[model samples]
Target chain A: MSFDGLWPYIYIAIAGWLATDLWRWAGVVAGNRIDERSEVLNWVRAVATALVAAVIAKLIVFPTGTLEASPLWLRLGAVAFGGLCFFIGGRFRQIAGIAAAIAFLAAGLALLGV
Target chain B: MTAPPESQSQSHWFLLGMRGIFSLPAIILMLSFVGFAAFTAEAKVPVEQVMFMTGMVWALPAKVILVGSMLSGAHIATAFLAVTLSSVRMMPMVAALIPEIRDRRTPTWLLLIVSHFVAITAWVFAMEKVRDVPRGGRVAFFAGFGVTLTLTNIVLVGLVYGAVSEFPPIVSGCLFFLTPVYFLTSIWISARHRVIYWALGIGLALGTIFAVVAPEYDILLAGVVGGTAAWWGERALRRREAAR
Candidate 1:
C-alpha cells in the first residue's frame, strides 16, 4: 500500500499527541535529577496545583459543552455546596463532596426546569 | 522519599492501585464524559478519530482544545501551541509524583512509562491516596489508577459518542458538573502547603478575569502568573518568619 494524502490525521498526531506528551516526558526528566525532598519539588507541586485550580475555575465560570447551558449560579453554587461537604466529610471527604455537588446540581437543574 | 514507618509496611500495591477502578474519582470521570460526546459529534469528527485521540491525547482538556481549534479552522501550529500550553500543568504533576512513587528500588523506565497517565484526575487522586501507601507500591498504585482511568474513559467516550445529543441540556449540564466539583475539592484537600491555598485563590481570581479579557491565553497566563506569585509570596513570608 502506498502512503497517500493523509495530512489531516498527520496534523492531528503532531498537534494533539506530541504537544501534550511533551510536558510529561519533560517532567519525568526534570523530576529524576532533583533531590526528592528539595524545595524545588515543592515549588513544582505548587505550580501544578495552581494550574489545575485555574482549570476548575474556568469550568465553572466559562464552561464549554453542555454545562454551558446551565446558569452560572447553578454551577458555582454546586461547587460551594460540594466544598462544604468536603471539609465536613472528614474521612470520606472526596466522596461526600462530589456526591453533594451532583445532588445539588441535578436538583437545581430540575427545579429550574419547573 | 517516604517516611521510615510507611516504607516498612508491605502490601500488594498493584491490587491496591487497580482497585481505584471502583473509586469515586473514577465514577465521576465517567459521569463527566457522558456529556462530552456532543462536542465531537457536533464537530462531525469521526468516532474513530475521537477514539484515536482518547488513547493518544488522554487529557480531556487537551482533547477539547484540539477539537476546538479544529472547529475554528485554526492552523496546525496554533493548535499545537494551544494544546501544549493547555497541558503544561502535567509537567509539575509528573515531576512531583515521580519522587513520591520512586522508592530506592523503583526504576526510571517504569516512572517514564506511567508518566503518560498523569492526567489531572488521576494525578490528584494518586497524590491524595498515595500518602498512606508504601513507597515501593506508590508507582503501582498510581499506575493502576491512571491506566484504569484512561481505559475506562476511552470506553465511556466510545459508548457515548453516538448517544450524547439526545440527552436533555439540564441533564447533560449536571452530569458535566461532576468534574469541577470533584476537581475543586480534591485539589483543595490534596495540597501539601498553605502556599497552594494562595495559588488556588489567585489562580481562580485571575482565571475568571482573564477569561473575560483574554480568552485565548486565560489558563496559561493565570496559571503561570498566579502560580509564580503565590510561590514567591510564600517564600518571602517564610524568610520574614525566619528572621524574627
Candidate 2:
C-alpha cells in the first residue's frame, strides 16, 4: 500500500511475466523446427497435455489455501462428478461438467459443516 | 485446414476471435478468474498485485503458483523456478498450435507478440475452430480470442477482487475448480491421439507421488516422465499389434 510495498509487486510482476512468457517464446523458437505431423510433434502435444494434467492432479491432491480445507476424497469426488456429467450432458457438456463440479464441491462442503 | 480463402480484414478476424468470450470455455475460464480473485483476497495478498499478475502474467496457473508459493513462504527464486518449469509445457503446445494457424507470410514479430496470449484455453479454442478460418485470418482470429480473453479476465478479476471478501471459502473453492476441470475435460476431449490418455493417467498418478518428494519440481518431472512413457508404451503396443 506504500512505497516500500511496491517492491514486492514489482518483483512479482517481473517473475510472473517472465516465468510464464518464457515458455511461449521457447515454443515459438522450438515450433519453427518441428514438422507439423511428425512423431516429434505428437510428443510435444503429449508432453504439454501431460504437464497440464500433472498440474491439475497436484492441485486436487495437495491444494493450498482454502481448497486445502476440503478433504482430498471430496475434491476427487467433485471432479468425478464433473467428468460423469461432461460425458453424458450432451450439447452443453462443458457447462454441465463445470456446474456439476461446483455443485458437488458445495454439497460436500456443506455435508462436512464447513 | 481446407483450401485457403482470400484474407479477411484484420478487424473481421479480431472480432471473430473476440466472439469466443461468450463460449462455454471462456465463460468457465472467467468463472475461474472469479475464484482466483476470491482465493487471493482470502490469503491477504495485495489486490493490485493479483490484478497485475492477471494481466501481465495472464496465465492462471502461473498466477496461482506465484501466490501459492508466496503464501507458503517460499524463496522468490524457488517460486520463479517452479513457475517457469510449469510453463515449459507451452513449448509443445504453441509449437503444435502456431503452425496450424499461420501462413508463410505471417510476420515473426506478430507471432511472437501474440503467442504470449496462447495459454491452454485459447490454444484449445483456436485449434478446435480455426480449421475453417482462412490462412491470412487465422492469426487475427487467434489473437482476437487470446488478447480479448486476457483483457476480459483481467478486468473481471479486478472487479471481483474487491468484493471477494464477502464470499465463503466453499464458494471460492468451487469457483476455482472450474478452470482445472475445464482444462481436464477439454484437453481429454480434444486430444489428437489415444496415447494422450496414457499420459494423463500417468501424470496424475506420478504427480501425487512427486508432490511429497519434490513439490517444487513435481509438475515438470511427472509430465516429462509420464509423457515419454506414454509415447514409448503406445509404440510398443503398436508393434505388438502388428506382430499379432
Candidate 3:
C-alpha cells in the first residue's frame, strides 16, 4: 500500500497503543500503594467491562464486515446459544466455548443454505 | 518476596501452557485473526505487512479497522474514528490490570510497550491467573503467553490468507461471527453489576437506533447515553434499596 494509505493505520496503531498504555503504566505506578479491590478500582473494572460490552453489543446489532451480511436472527440466535454454552461451562470454559459455538452454529446455518 | 500461598501451591508450567492453549476464546481469536489476515491479503495487503502489524502494532480490532477501511475505500478520518472508539475499551482494561503489576522496581515506560499485547485473552488470563503468580513473574508469564498467542495468530492469518480464495462466502461470514458472539457471550455470562448491565443494554439499544439515523456518532452517543444512564440508574436503585 502507498504511504498515504498506510498513514491512518500507523497513526491509529500508535495513538491507540499510547492511549491504552497510559492506563497500564498508570496501573503499575498507582497499583503499588492501593488495595486492588478498592471501590475505585472496582468501579474502574465495572466501567471497563461495560465499555467492552457496549462494543460487543454494537458489533452484534450493527456489524460491518461479513457478519453484517449474515441473517440478523441467525446471528442473534447464535449469540444466545453461545451464552447458553458460557453459562453451562462455568466462567473459564464458557468464556471460550461461547464464541466457538456461535461460529459453529453460524457456519452450520450457512451450510444448510439458510 | 514470600510466594503467595496460592501460587506456590500450583506450579504447573505444563498446565499453564495447556490452559492457555485450550482456552476457547484464544483459539477463536486466533482463527478469526487468520481469517482476517487471509481476507486482507485477498484484498491485496502484503503478508509481510500483516505479520509486522501482528507483532508490532498487536491490536487486532485496529488491524481489522485499518484493513477493512482500506478495502472499503473509507476515509482515513472515518477509519481512525472507528478504531479510536473501539480501542477506548482498552482504557478500562488497563485500569483493571495496572494496579496488579505496580511495584518499586518496575518501569512504567517498559510496561507501556508491553501493554500492546494486552488483548482480551491476555486480560482474561491475567485477571484469573495473575493473583496466584508472584508479582515479578506475572509480567514474564503474560509476556510468554502473549508471544505465543501472537505467533499463533500470525500463522493462522497466513494459512487463511493462502486459502482465502477457496473459502466460501458463508464460511468467511462464520469466521467473522466469532468476535460478536464471543463479546455477547462473555458479557451475558460474566458481567454482574446491575447498573453496568442496564447501561450496556441501554447503550446498545441507543447505539443501534442512533446508528440507523446517523452511523458516525453511534458509538459516542451510545457510550454517553449508556454510561450516564447506568450511573444515574445505579445511584437511584441503590438509594431505593437503602430506603427499603
Which number leads on TM-score? 2
User: Residue-wise lDDT of candidate 2 within A1-114, one digit each (tens)?
Assistant: 232467667667666888888889888877777776788877777776678788888778877667887888899999999989999989888778878988998999888976
DockQ of 3: 0.36
Q: Taking the true A–B contacts (Cα pairs closer than 8 Å), what share appears in each candidate?
A: 0.71, 0.70, 0.31
**Comparison by lDDT, 2 against 3, better one:** 2
Q: Rank the candidates by DockQ, best first.
A: 2, 1, 3
lDDT, candidates in the order shown: 0.81, 0.80, 0.63
The positional error of residue B106 in candidate 3, measured at the CA in angstroms, is 3.7
Candidate 3, residue B203: the lDDT equals: 64
Best by DockQ: 2
- Let me know the TM-score candidate 3 reaches against the reference structure: 0.76
- Pairs with steric clashes in candidate 1: none
Model 2, runs deviating above 4 Å = A1-6, B1-9, B68-78, B239-244
> TM-score order of candidates, best first?
2, 1, 3
TM-scores, all models, native as reference = 0.88, 0.89, 0.76
DockQ of each: 0.54, 0.62, 0.36
Better of 1 and 3 by TM-score: 1
| Candidate with better DockQ, 1 vs 3 | 1
Model 3 misplaced regions, further than 4 Å: A1-35, A85-104, A111-114, B1-19, B72-82, B103-105, B132-136, B187-203, B235-244
lDDT tens string, model 3, B172-217?
A: 6767767766655555545555765776677667767766886765
